[model samples]
Structure formats: C-alpha cells, structure tokens
Target: MMLFQHHNTGIHLDSGSTFHLRTNEDDFKEGSLQGIHGGFHYASNVKGRELYQEGIDKVFDSVCKLDTRASDNVNSLSNMVQDGFDVFMDTNRENSFFVTRNGTTWRFGHHCRVPQKAED
Candidate 1:
C-alpha cells in the first residue's frame, strides 16, 4: 500500500492490485474508478469471483478507515494552527513536520503546514 497526494488530494493505492482510493469525491464523479472492474476482471478468473470480491471489500474497508483517520488528523492539525500553533516542515523526512503549540511539540508526517487563522 502507498499513500500520496496529487492536486491537493490524498490517494491510497494497493500495490498488489489496481485498487485504489481517492480522498476527493470529485475524482469518483470524474470517473477515476470507471475502468476498475476491467483491471480486476482477471483476478476473479484466477480466484473465485466471491473470493475476489471479498478481498476487494476488505481492502476497501481498510482504506476507508485509514482515510477517515487521516482526515481527522488533518482537521486536528488545522485547529491547532488556528489556535496559534506553528508547523515547520522537517527537512530530514519526507512529508514530516514539527508542530509546536504553547511550547508543547509533536511530530506528524504526511502533512505540512495548516492554514493560519484569519485576522479579525
């Protein structure tokens, strides 16, 4: 499994198969998953169709749960930034950042700076 972002949207790809999840709803509306059945058609032939469906279902469930947690983390970070926290990107690690809030520090990866709170 690999997680990455494109055009400011998160994507989770299963390396074993062509199955993937997109964070943006628009990606689905735009038919990003249109040809997915065709890609996995052979899997049903090799494995029973029921087994293939079950495996895909499991992967889909896991991906959905992961995406939910990621979204929650992002929201929490955004709130912190709004409440005067500062996030500095970590140069040593890709997609990592140092988040400081009221002198308490935490590190998180797969996210960078959150938008600053608007002035009154």
Candidate 2:
C-alpha cells in the first residue's frame, strides 16, 4: 500500500529515525489484495480457495492478539503480509526511501526507509 507522508505528525524511535507517515485512514487502505490469491502455491488447485481462507484465518487470529493499533502504527503493512503480499524495496533512489508492493508504492518519511532497520 502507498503510505503518504504526513503533513506534520512524526514518530521518533530509539534508533533516532523519525517516521512521519500520514495517519489518515484512507492513506493506507487504497490497494488491492487479489494479487495475493493469484500468487499462492495452491492458486490453481481446486482447494485453493479453502487453503487461502484457512491461511487468512490463522493470520487474522494472530493480528487480533497484537496490541498495536492501526491508528498509531504500520498495521496495514502487517495486514498486507498476512494476505500474502510481497514488498519490494525501491532501488531507483540513492537514499533509503519508499518501497512498493503489488502496484502501490509506499513513500516513507525522511527516516522511515527500511521498516525493520527503523525499528531497531
């Protein structure tokens, strides 16, 4: 999903990186997840739908147990992953920046480059 930079709000972690992503509900919700189903290993099988539903159930159950709130974090990213989305790092820029998944490019804040590294 595309994460637009917020106008002002920012989050600073212990690593000194600052994430200034837009918290607006729509910013991270405008994307399609159908690609995930198509890429699944069992997508061509007769039981593909059942397999996908089962996988989704497991992930949804896990997410429900997390304390993180969609309003305050990159919850959409997790949701995307659970649905079988694969994120691709943007390589066109010299500096660490946005990343893409499916057809959406998620732009990041000045310090919100690599999500994992930013957490550290």
Using lDDT as the measure, the top candidate is 1
Off by over 4 Å in 1: 1-76, 92-94, 111-120
In candidate 1, what residue range of length 10 has the lowest lDDT sum?
51-60
Local distance difference test, each candidate? 0.32, 0.30
Native-vs-model 2 lDDT?
A: 0.30
Q: Number of clashing pairs, model 1?
A: 0
What is the alpha-carbon lDDT of model 1 when measured against the actual structure? 0.32
lDDT of 2 at 13: 20
* Cα lDDT tens digits for candidate 2, 36-88: 34332322213322211111111112121111122333234444454454544
TM accuracy, model 2: 0.26
Error of 2 at 85 (Å): 2.7
Extract clashing residue pairs from model 1. Answer: none
TM-score of 1: 0.27
Candidate 1 lDDT by residue in tens digits, 1-120: 133321333332222333233333333332222223333332322352211111111211222111211231122334335547586775665455555655544444443332221211
